[model samples]
Target: MTDHGPTREELPFPDYDHLPITGLAHRIRSLDLAQLRVVIEYEEAHARRVPALQVLQTRASELEAGAEPSGGDPSALAPELSPAPSAGSSVSPATAPGPDIPPTESDEAKPPMRG
Candidate 1:
């Protein structure tokens, strides 16, 4: 019988090199102090890579210590680049309402249907 070598389907390691490090760093930087702790815990459990873990741990510590700038602050090394909401804007009606369907006009006070 001929020996059948392991196929690519049997590859043991997942390819992480292709992951977008810059994008991840931006997201991590945006996390609040509490959320950052959760992310750090997840990183420790799964990937556990030294360099990446170090970066996350350092940022988390800085946030916990109140030494880190807010993610949106331009002074931050990796500033949050997400768009900012306009000031004094009310919450949009669609999202403000709960998952339940909103009441129809019939449910509210209405002038009797015009002829």
Candidate 2:
């Protein structure tokens, strides 16, 4: 609740306001107690979203219980925001249909395109 550390703008996760509850939960795991406090205070003053507050509080409790913060760059891009792989999708020949598979055909009874 105190303003002892970073403000909302200075939060460990720069995109905190846009993060979903699940993402917030994951990101906060790497924050220490002080950083969590900043998030909690900001949330209380702005959104006051109960779920987000709960997640922050839970992590604070874990830190209070002597759990060390997880290792990661707090300012790193969020997983959802990371650039897609340059190699493209995971789909491969094994996952695609084989050439032998017949393409679907319209019902013969159906009228042909008027255009």
Candidate 3:
């Protein structure tokens, strides 16, 4: 059998910043043993501040001990800010997908001949 390795979903890294403290905490109260090691390493290298590091450590302990940490809904943390795309006149030709070339040439397609 061919090995595809692990998919992105299988990976432990969280996607959005909002997820680290909220969504991810609910999903996995504590990091897995292996993942804890990674978190410690990342925390040491980047965020050495006490409060953030303490939070990670606390979550790590909870995971090791099997307990849930309290946090807000991941969805509730961030408002859905994207505006809907405007209709018709606002649409760009580049974004409109098709085979590109016109199926048939019209009278306007011909250029005037020069003397």
**lDDT tens string, model 1, 1-115?**
1133333222221122223455455555656766555555555555667776777788878777786544463123333244356787676886585688876987777766688
Local distance difference test, each candidate = 0.53, 0.79, 0.50
Every candidate's CA RMSD: 17.7, 9.5, 13.4
Give the range where candidate 1 is weakest over 10 consecutive residues by summed lDDT: 8-17
What does candidate 3 score on TM? 0.36
Candidate 2 per-residue C-alpha lDDT over 43-103 given as tens digits, one digit per residue, 9 for 90 to 100: 8878889999988998899899999999997777887565545977879988997688544
What residue pairs clash in candidate 2, if any at all? none
**Residue 108 lDDT (model 1):** 73
Query: Per-prediction TM-score, please?
Result: 0.40, 0.63, 0.36
Q: Is candidate 2 or 3 superior in TM-score?
A: 2
User: Best TM-score goes to which candidate?
Assistant: 2
Q: In candidate 2, which residue ranges exceed 4 Å CA deviation?
A: 1-7, 81-115
Per-model tally of clashing residue pairs = 0, 0, 1
As a whole number from 0 to 100, the lDDT of residue 115 in candidate 2 is 69
Stretch of 10 with least lDDT, candidate 2: 1-10
Off by over 4 Å in 1: 1-19, 68-115
